[model samples]
Target: MPKKFEEFKLNRQILNAVEEAGFTEATPIQEKAIGPVLSGQDLFGIAQTGTGKTAAYVLPMLMKLKYAQGENPRALILVPTRELALQIEEQVRLFSTYTDLRTVVIFGGIGPKTQKEQIAKGLDILVATPGRFLDLYLTGDINTRSLQFLVLDEADKMMDMGFIGSIHRILEVVPRKRQNLLFSATMSDLVHKIAGDFLKNPLTIEVAAQATPAQTVTQKMYAVPNFKTKINLLAHLLKDDEFKRLIIFCKTKTVADNINNFIARRFGEDAVRVIHANKGQNTRINSINSFKEGNVRILVATDVASRGIDVSEVSHVINFDVPIVTEDYVHRIGRTGRAFNEGIAITFYNEAERYYIDKIEKLIRQKIDEEEIPQSIFIEETPFDERQAIAREIDAQKRKENPDFKGAFHEKKKQYTSPTKKNNKKSYPSKNKKRR
Candidate 1:
């Protein structure tokens, strides 16, 4: 039987807020993690996305903080990206509705003047990206003397983004006696190294295996021949009403833009939006809001949005390009099958992407079911340039595996004609006649 929130003995005010939030029972991660958090122990958690991990730590921390009487923040949550910072802040606000717990979220891509002002006004919980947090801390706007709880959300992504130095710096500034919580979807070597340094005899929690996708998501893939054909397959899939709300993840900003244009042209302007690192902060926020409100049917984005988005009821997540970083495969598909909702994940891969597909399967410990392309959709022939590109990519992969391996694009040695009597005699006679 699942555990109920009431059994956790939370305060009446927080119970009321939980009831209003419509959360009756605790998720597995929440059930196991909340107790340790409330007991004030350093913890290291390994769970995939959409597992209610945020609330696992947030609720207990809120209960501990109680009435929120502090001039500076008592609890700090650090995330990798601006989107995730906003998402965590939203969660903190929702659960702390019945209390006076003030919250502020700070991130980069915008000026820090307003964020500093908010900090000056006093807050109980501070959610911020590492870079912006360091910036504010350096400016003397943030006080760490009163911090009691520290949480690192998506620690693996933070490591991937090369925020280790910033994290180390933040660790140096914060008080050493505080409780620490580190949550990550995958446990890489780097995460392990940080965990060794960050935690103090912490309790370890593993709700699921590392890099595993949620069971609620059905996985499927198609062997697409070329870029145009992949687009055609996408169009065919979208024609069905079942693909109600979907996110298409691309490998690069250029591909994301191309997909956005194609989808917009086919489904009209309001049906789609694209987001990437180059897009402005307001544009990214507004696009996410539009998608969440159902104003947009499709969102095209790169991996920057992979672990950041928290939308539930997403019908499908399409991988327009296979991620070279295998762990990201888990985060990309995790966007759907959220909140225990049944969802589907579809991937389109060309010949060169098979290498990444294999790595993903190994990481997830499951083989994605492959399906043939529908005959109704026209299969475009691979363009010469695209074919060469694929070949070059394959060669690079091979060279990465073996340094001495020569690529297929290398110059070919001239073939020496064997001494055939007829060919050799004819060559001599032709040479004599030419001389004459």
Candidate 2:
């Protein structure tokens, strides 16, 4: 049975646009969210990315504003990153094509004056990153006092990026009486706090369990001995003709660059590309575009690509490094297996990485099917070694992140434990400098 937009009470114009855009079926998230949103109810929607979330919010917002249009806007959507904000703006324009609505997007990395001018011209829907939105709001250029709808898209990523402070500030400026919709692939404590604060008797529309991996994706693991063998394994997999449009995820910017260099050194410079936190916005966008156009066969990226990457035809996802969080694994694998396409996700594992595997299983709620090691691939190489050196390097990286941390003693590393100091009488002699 073909599902029509009218069945969900979507108006004629939106139904026409959906058909024109070639969307014949409502995705699970949309099917659940659109009805509640159209009736002017607060919603907390949880669904994996590329499942038509942008349209889910945009369609309802557009319908609500169809009978009414005004400058200075009644709706506001906040996203965590500039890429997501712009993507939302693009979708808004597409979905609101038949209407005379004015949707403006504000984000960093560009001059604020232009954004101010666009907002000054009047906006019916404003999609913005939290920082820039606060910037213009503080400047008295943005008037969100009349805002009627607030959508916090990708609430998990927003909290991860430290936007809670800005989100709070923006909420303070906007009218208290409004509809708040929160959408994310995973539900976290941070998300719960926001829901507690912003939503009033909200409808919870969770398409699946939190941190759940998409059913269209099949995940596998390879217990590579160490980093070098991991590289060789990546190379070998890349050389296979079936590995098309691959996104190799690395743990850090340096690792992403290193893996990109390794792939480029053997294969050509154009064969693989890397994007990470240090990349400029233009470079990141260009790399994403080139990869989308098939100019770059492989894209090695950090967590930046874990969200906001909407490409649909990825054939394989290789985790060059295991994800630090299990929720990230779901987002990483979700980059592929989209739009009903079957895709494969492969991860390199070592002894140290085994701890994350169970967490990943528990999050996805399924045991990952293991494949027998292809001995021919390992036969030519020296025997594999567990990643003790890699562990040391990761430990050093952790120390760099938290220098003041005095690590807890582990049974295996007890030999390396430092001796504790005994309290000395001389050290606290009359402990009062003021007495002097």
Candidate 3:
């Protein structure tokens, strides 16, 4: 195994940048993946977040591109989210600082004229989301004939977001002979199918067991009764000084907004910021940057921001609600315990969410330690409507587990309505009977 990054045969400029970045040794993924990528082979890598997978590809890509002399981008990177595109572009810039390589990032939510202007200036590396990339390509602004490398970062995420059609269209446009690299945290069937279409007998690299959480993060769970109790538990947890910098992950924009308001009210406005799809692009970017810079103590976000946003030294990751997407649990907690740092992940699940929690545990291949709810925290009774909703969900889950089993709601409807209808028919007065 290589002791340091220099052993990977990277160019002097990349070496200098890596040293400056303080990466003393190659991470497991980086150590294993850099060689094949540098050898100009198609690669399929399975690794979790914070495994230094970005550098594994970025360094080699930079070395291959060497100096910038192209009228268009020689390499194209497709990410699932705009934040990921921006983050990858930042990484490309960081690694290519000492070199002459130029990088540009294009995504949705901003006017294309600016992106077109940047592309017209010429670049070696172009990082983009599928929608924006295809739009610029179809508009005759981007020239893909010169593309030599194609990378699909977070391939599973792209598939989850229904980008397969865009990916197919992109494949039609880009040169067929270019190298391909795919990186995903989980190797789902969809990912494999896309890989078969994209890669040419690729080298498969699995750094760890698929869908497993990072070992550096300590995982625990709290069984709150309802939304209000969840808030109470969260407030109690935030009181601990250990939770210096934290992220609260919610399932929806509405939940994220509510959590943001609650936290801000309790902890003050200066300490909290919220990011979700509903927020304006600039606002989302600013909130994320603020959290990354430690200007804010807490960030409330939905799953849309879960996969690619990298913040350093995050002390804790709190799941404000159980993610319905089982795989998301891994990515959500991955916000903490980055770069081999010790961090904690606390999840709050009510009775309805336990089904999702079970799926998450099965995906991660481990049970989360259950933490007792403190007596000091207020446990609110589940609201009537919320209780009904929870019961319906539970019944649905039970039916899913056993197809022969009827749901509680179904049984109740059948029992009460059917018997009442039978009784009414049996008791109906006939014309033959005399009036009472």
Candidate 4:
């Protein structure tokens, strides 16, 4: 039997908000993480996305904070991406609604003046991306001396995004004696290293092995022949009303934009939206808000932009491209089957992507079921240019694994041809004989 939220002995303000938010029972991660957090212990949590990890940290932090106090923030939550920072800030607001705790979210891609003004007005909790947080701290807009609680959410993603230096800088600025909490979906080596720097004898919690997908999500894959076939299959899938709310994850911004344009043309402009690093902050926010609010039926995005944006009851997650980073496969599919809701994750891959699929399966410790594409959906033949591109990519990956292995594109060096014997003798023998 699972424990109820009441067992955690949360304060009335937090309890009311939890109830108002319609969460009666604690998730596995939440149940396990809350107690340690409330006890003011340094904690390192290993839990996947959609495991209620946000509330696991947020609820207890709220309980610890109780009510807002001074001008400087007491609790600081550092996230890897702007999307995550905004999402955490939203969670802070939702949970802290019944209390007087004021929260602000700060990230880049926008003017700092507004954020500085918000900081000036005083906040109890600050959720920020590393660069923006450090910027404010360096400019004296944020004071870290009074910080009591330091949380690094999505620590693995932070490391993947190359925020280690910024994280180190932050660790230096914050009070050395403060409580630390580090949460990540996967406990990679770098995550462990950073955790060593942040946490002090932390209670380690692992709800599940890292990189495992939620059981509620049915995973399957289509062996697509080319990009056009992926688009065709995507169109086929979206025709079903069961996939009313969907997110298509692409590997790069260029791919994301192309997919978004294709989807927009097929479905009306209002029916589809896209988000990536190149998008304006407001545009990204509005796109996410629209998708969350169900005003947009589909959102095409890159992996980085999709981090920390949560929408409950997402019908499906479609991987338009195989993620080179194997761990990201788990995060991408995690967008669906959230909160124990049944959902589906469909992946489209060509032959070249098989290597990544194998890596993903190995990391997750499970095989993704293969699905045969229906004959009605035309499979585009691999064009010569595209074929060569894929061959080169595969060859490159092979070379990384085995430097001595020559690839499909590798051609034997042309045999050096010596001049004909008679011609060489005629040209060189007279001078050589004279010298000899």
Candidate number that wins on lDDT, 1 or 3: 1
lDDT of each: 0.91, 0.79, 0.88, 0.87
**Residue pairs with backbone atoms closer than 3 Å in model 3 (clashes):** none
Model 4, C-alpha of 254: deviation from truth (Å): 2.0
State the lDDT of candidate 2 residue by residue for 1-436, as single tens digits. 5355768776788778777877888788888888889888999888877677888888988888884456687889999877677668877887777778888898888788888898888879999889998888889888876788999998988888888888888878889889889998887888889878888999998887877778889899887655666776777788899998989999899989999888899999989888888898889888888998899999999987777677789999999888977778888898899888889999987655766787788878888877654644542232212223444545655565688644432356564343333222222122212211
Q: Is candidate 1 or candidate 2 better by TM-score?
A: 1
Would you estimate the TM-scores of all the predictions?
Answer: 0.93, 0.85, 0.93, 0.93
Error of 2 at 53 (Å): 2.0
lDDT (Cα) of model 3? 0.88
Predicted model with the maximum lDDT: 1
Q: Which has the better TM-score: candidate 2, or candidate 4? A: 4
For candidate 4, write residues 1-436 as lDDT tens digits.
Answer: 7889988869888888989998998899999999988888999999989999999999998988888798999999999888988888888899998999999999998999999999999999999999999888889999987799999998988999899999999888888888899999887899989998888999999998877988899999998877877888898888888988999999999999999999888888989999998999899999999999999999999997656679988899999999988888889999998998988999998878998999999999999999988867876665555655676789888998999998655665222123355643442232111111
Off by over 4 Å in 4: 410-436
Clashing pairs in 4: none
List pairs with backbone clashes in candidate 2. Answer: none
- Residue 436: error of model 2 in Å? 75
Lowest summed-lDDT stretch of 10 residues in model 2?
427-436
